[model samples]
Target: MSEKKPSLLEGFKAFLMRGNVIDLAVAVVIGAAFTNIVNAVVKGVINPLVGAFGTKNLDSYSSCLKAPCEVGPDGEMQGIQIMWGSVLGATLQFLITAAVVYFLMVLPMARYLARREAQRKAKEGVQETLEVTELEVLKEIRDALVAQRAGGNAGPEGSPAPGDRG
Candidate 1:
């Protein structure tokens, strides 16, 4: 009998359902939403602060390659312009987003996971110690019983051995 191959749709569904894929999708959606907030902060707070040096409107800060740039009646321009201000704004937005995600999400999650792992290891260490102690106790009891049998004093109320002291 030939083994049936999974359909393409089934494979795609499985890939989508995988934990990493789902997490990435969620992250993308969250990042997209976070981008808006970050943009607002950069535009509102940062640009104004930088405006102390120059102007608040960064988009207008550009160098026209062709001098005498044509201007319309409605305060519009037409010329080859290098918009470095917009680039600066975009760059700042990216840096802020990365920093926020690292501190707010990645750093906290890593710390929490580390703490959880430490607690689990501590519990396991305690359990291991208990197991070792139990084994040692059992061995002692067996040795005591053997000694009593050899001495022909294996009664219910036999004298306690040195190792058998409570």
Candidate 2:
């Protein structure tokens, strides 16, 4: 009999029920909240520190690439301006976030997984050795029984050999 195929809704539900998808959703939410904190730190602490040498607002720092850049009374730019300072600020935030996540989360998880794998392998090795030892003992017992039967010069139950009795 041909098996019935699952419907599209069933397949979608199964995908959503997986642990990885739920974990990813949670991570995305947390990451969004973390971005806000990183943005605040950049705007508050880092900006003031960098502001010591120049303007405090990173977005305000720019260069006239076209040499005719001008801001009108309505705060409209007339030429191309390269905003390198904003890019630097964004880069710093990303680096800080990445470093923290790697050191605090990724590295420890990796080490734990490696340790667990090693323990599993060691346990399997012990079980395999025990099996091999048991097999060797069984073979030894079988060989002894075969040799005793072949000799047959003595009777059963510790009695003297038939030819030894005078």
lDDT of 2 at 102: 96
Model 2: per-residue Cα lDDT over 10-114, one tens digit each: 999999999999999999999999889878888888889889989898878888898678987889888899999888888888888898789989999999999
* Count of clashing pairs, candidate 1: 0
Alpha-carbon lDDT, every model: 0.86, 0.88
TM-score of each: 0.72, 0.73
lDDT of 1 by residue, 71-150 (tens): 86888887777888998888888899899989999999999999999999999999999999999999999998788768
Q: Which parts of model 1 have CA positions greater than 4 angstroms off? A: 1-21, 62-82, 152-166
